[model samples]
Target chain A: MQSGDSLPELAPGDLPRQFTSRAALQQHLQQLFPSASGALSPIVGGWAAAQERLAAVDPGAYGRSRNHLAGAVTHLSPYIRHGVLGLAAVRDAVLGRITRRPEGEKLVNELGWRDYWQRLWGQLGDGIWDDQEPLKTGHPASSYASELPADIAGGSTGLACMDAFAAELRATGWLHNHARMWLAAYVVHWRRVRWQAGARWFLQHLLDGDPASNNLSWQWVASSFSHKPYLFNRANLERFGAGHHCQGCPAARRCPFDASYEALEQRLFAVTPTPRRR
Target chain B: MTAAPMTATPMNSPILWIHGAALGPANPALVAWPGRPAVFVFDDALIAGSALSLKRLGFLYECLLELPVTIRRGDVASEVLAFAARHQADGVVTTAAVDPRFRQLGQAIAARVPLTVLPVEPFVAPEAGGPQPGDLGRFSRYWRRAEPLVWQRFKG
Candidate 1:
């Protein structure tokens, strides 16, 4: 059958037939559907594997360092996103493991963020694509570029952190939450691109990409869904990013993000007073 | 002391609709009705229209390998209904989804066949005896009301 054919014929035998080896299946898929020949890794996809991943989440470490580049972040998002692992099951696993309420709270709270986004998506419907609230940033909402610039898409942006992030997103299909925030901010705030443009780009690459979570988060960074646009400075990146990208960056001295948060706030939000509820 | 008389209803066997939102054995819908035949559709129109990448599709392909599911491609609702008819299923059972597109698909399917949606298991629970809140704009406010109830069902 053709790759895009509407109906695939089922084998006449048993259900849940044993799948061929990962490499073999991948090879078969590659030849049958040549377009899917990216650096896609077939992450072991089942309940047993998800449970194993859930068991390894260290809530305490995650709570303390989740914002850092090398934080103890749980990598179970792909599993959770696709329903291989239910959200409640993961919450139970974390709560069951960590004795301290405070430690577990952060991880649970993060999960709650996912729930919140899904709830919003349900309530808003297609409206999630539109700004929930008016743009609070200095620039008018209409002024934002609808298409992502070639530089950003190609990872040729002169900025060191952003280029690294772009490359990481393409190669690994994942990024830390903090990295995501920073990249989204730069795309919307600095590059003058719309959140939708960035959101679409992200959806194409992320393994755990969900429209509710991904689109809503982009809107959050754009200040269209939140009170203020999120912006970060060089110092924040250097501290949390582990400085690997900075070490090899050619723009180390004349960094675009050399200013403080206040300076950035002034530059990006010039003339516009601290965003008040419309 | 008394039991209602059993009536012959049109709905009997349930066919699991393994949607993109819930794609594996842990799916609550699957858990509710085990050993039932399952169906998955690779909607070309949806994939072609959206920014979904080949890698994401590849990931989904991998996930389907773990389940005893019949995979197909076409309009989601039509394909699902077709599968149900072929399997002699009286109704379709699928995991609840918050995505609007999925809801639309469910409604479309329901128009043609009986559709039952199971709740997404293992997340924050609704407030006890309290009305389900509508304000989802911020996380902090939502969590304050939801925190106490998230683990309400936990046995640990």
Candidate 2:
């Protein structure tokens, strides 16, 4: 379906009979956007290439390079998120390529995690969106008078990593899965912005912005998901983001915490002692 | 921001109610405790409350004279804790959905105070027919395909 077009009305029977494989789907997609051949061709071609890569590559490579922020990581999240690539199809492809190998076991576990998150979403239902800010009760984050919207969407954040990520999201409507975690953490913990704000920004921009993944991921970084909060330190920034690109990072001098990263992290993590249950 | 008026004496223990749905039989958990400072933890979908399910919830809330509660939207565990802390809530109540992450969070919160998990079945309006076998199959297929990448976890 073309972007911005209304979903075509379909009766239950009108839906496609059998699920189409990602490769077959990509071939059909190419026909829809033939004019932009060179620019789009590789994305279609990349699906095939990724399938091949999954066959021969080790799962360790995924863990290692997933955080590079540049394009080295597998860009499969968006495809999977949008249902452009089916999870079972991808799993089957990966499994077919590495059956009985140690890598296959590792990859299958990773797949299982996705299911786990989804199950969590189903289990929790709407409780997942409840507000959990400390000190401030019921004060929604100010969407107005905030640079967050422009910074995230317009790529004007000035932090090299943040800016690059924002730009990449806008340009390609995709971010590597690891980068998404980093960005969400930065926005919620380091930047001291509200998780809802970041969530809204992602929903507006990400092509694969599933409600479960985007909302849950933001909650995880905000320390809202777990009792202990997670903070991304300068050491982490330097390690994963070796490229040193953004010159305008608000946290440049202070690195991770001068930007209030630790406090933000602690805010989400520190759990007040609950009274003993009867 | 203006401070909320202190009408009644603060309860010795306050319950933080985290709701995942926008509407239905379970919504009373959110709207019932009026005047007691409770936090309403919800997600974009429920806040959007555009779905048929949630619309019913809004109507329910409107009909009830809710206790003093704070409405906040977020993912499950974090939102519940944040709401509890922000509101100085002594406990939490939520529906039983199978989010291990939220369950873990609930367990941790329970250690601190009371975390009550309410098992709620989706209340489809009577007029709405249940999903046919085919519809269930389509949804199942969609989930199976989306499961791997969407649900993959890191083994550290």
Candidate 3:
């Protein structure tokens, strides 16, 4: 935060040492910046690995099932976020594979979302940290807690799907886009935690986390950037998230999200749609 | 009108500034000035005081190994200035960032030295005639304007 003349004194031996392997580096970093609970394994690094990953993205399959838990999601987000693979390079790779433009439209559109978030940050500056618009939902902004609950952070929320997502995020440093949406919704809407709290927690863990994309997306889920608060139900979860997290979930019968979307919407918001002010 | 892109040319002295978001070979700034001594600093004031995890730091360390970047630690702007002065570099160049903090540091660096900010390679290019970003609030609106030329490959 300091400039040349007003620089603060850095601790002795603050420079990063030459790391021979990922494990060595993780171990060294642990000595300095310890993680909250579980730590993430090192993802594949370098441009060669990133390019190889890029080549493996099947746009057709991605468009078909990206929302499902078991989907053909291009795990290229971490690389793209870190600048290992440039955006143009990924687009070219995707476009070269599909025969028609529409074949890659969904994937391309998703990429555009990343750009849109970046553009907003460039325009908004620190405004991205605050609520962009008034909450369209009935919930008041002041009513939400500014910090995440210990139960949610510890991945023991008694909600199987949410806990699994938290565990996966802690272990992998990545999550599917749909999974991210669900997690944010659960945190901000269901848990009533501030978007900033969830945003910071995600930034702390996610390898692909960018303040613009991550925070703004969280805001969107919280109804601070979007027209309505995003919500999901048991049926929706079962349709898209039934595989791993739901397989042997002990909390299956006791699931809090057992109702339908409409029921939950009525219960949570309890009002007519707030008309857009064109 | 937008100024002409300041393409990095073969120069006697130029330094590349690689931060959290700009840390790889594909980095446009590093690509623009290849073979220059790039420096990645772990801003102590920032890292020690924030919720930065060991995983991110480790990931950054792994990425830096693949490039010829010299890793340093301390105040970001100050370290970059010292690194430039120590190497007696005439100018600095880096990838443009949307992060306000990064942009603040970039502006500070530009005020002191010749800093060239290069655009990141876009995933999708804007169409010749389209609505500006300010006009759009939702992703669907932005996509409508940008999708036409975003993936359209130019024919020779």
Candidate 4:
């Protein structure tokens, strides 16, 4: 397993820059940073990898189907998060491909979201950790648990979709944006855990764990940064998820998410309907 | 005679300090000095505080490996300063970092050696000779100002 050359020994207090394989690299990192738990992600990170993903962007399809589980989404967040691929470069690539403005508008607008998060981070500094706005949900902040429960963390939530999302996060260090929103909503709204606890849990595992994006999005789901907590019913999940999690799942008999948004909102929020606009 | 714009010439053996924010070849500092001695320090505080998984760390290491930077982990300021002294460099050159922690480290390194913060290419640069983009309170407001600017670069 010659990666490039034989893996080099660590210099005095300096980390080794060479490895024979991804496994070797993972093992070396396991030894080097013991506090960092979990295995290597299937997603390789480098300029070449980022460019390869960039080359495959289908702007027309991406704009149309990006919200679905099996959508034509660009798996570029991890690389983009770390600045392995710059935002402008990605934008230019998208713009270069489209014949019509509408084709690339959605993808470019998504890039704008990334830029927006960074700008907020610059403005807020560490204040991104705090709630940007008070929760519109009737429940008080003290009602949420301060830590992520072990069942959720261990992927034993008895709900197939959430457990699978947790497994994917722990194993791969990445999740589709929909999965993140769904899993985060479950943690905060259904489980009554603090968004900060869930945010910290995500930061521990997400490859794209930029505090600006992760925390703010968590705050969005928690109704601290948005007008209302983002919610999804079983039909919404089953529709977009392509019936992946519900066919033979243990939770199928009595799924927690098995209700309409209206019903779920009434049950979870206990307040009047949350305002839809900012 | 017409006034000429100044070019950013390389300094006296300034060490190219690469941070997580600017690891790619497109980094302004890297663009200024392509192959000069460069170092990337994995800040200890950031790792332990976030409890960063090996997955992310490995990703970063692989990215740095693709570049010509020495990989080091410790107190970021100390390691960067040590790397600068090791090269007998007159200064440190880095692209600006958004994170406050890195800005503090840049200050420490600058206190010891001349440090230059180069401008990165923004996703949407401010209007030429106009007031800065305003009202970042929401994405819609910001995009109303930025979306037009972003598409102005498109030739298609």
Best by lDDT: 4
Give the C-alpha miss distance for residue A33 in model 1, angstroms.
Answer: 4.8
- Share of real contacts kept by model 3? 0.47
Q: What is the per-residue lDDT of model 1 for residues A50-157, given as tens digits with 9 covering 90 to 100?
A: 777788899999989998999999988888788877787778788888766877878988888888887777777788888888877867877889999999978898
User: Model 3 segments beyond 4 Å from truth?
Assistant: A1-18, A32-40, A270-278, B1-11, B154-156
- lDDT (Cα, 0-100) at A16 in candidate 2: 23
> For model 1, what is the error of residue A246's alpha carbon versus the real structure, in angstroms, after optimal superposition?
0.7
True contacts kept of each: 0.46, 0.04, 0.47, 0.63
lDDT (tens digit, per residue) of candidate 3 on A46-74 = 56668778878999899888888898888
Candidate 4 residues A83-146, lDDT tens each? 7888888999999999999999999999999988888888888899998998877899999999
DockQ top scorer? 4
Clash pairs, candidate 4, are none
Candidate 1 RMSD to the real structure: 5.5
Interface DockQ of candidate 2: 0.03
lDDT at A140, model 4: 91
Residue pair clashes in candidate 1 = A6-B73, A16-B68, A87-B122, A88-B122, A88-B123
Per-residue lDDT of model 2, residues A1-278, tens digit only = 11112222333212121214534433432343232211122233223333453445455565446566543455555444422234555565665554344555545555545544555556446665654333221223442123465566567766667778877665555677666777876676446677777776675556445456777667665555543334555555666667474355665774443334444444443333221110
| Candidate 2 chain B, poorest ten consecutive residues by summed lDDT | B1-10
C-alpha RMSD by candidate, in order: 5.5, 19.3, 5.6, 4.2
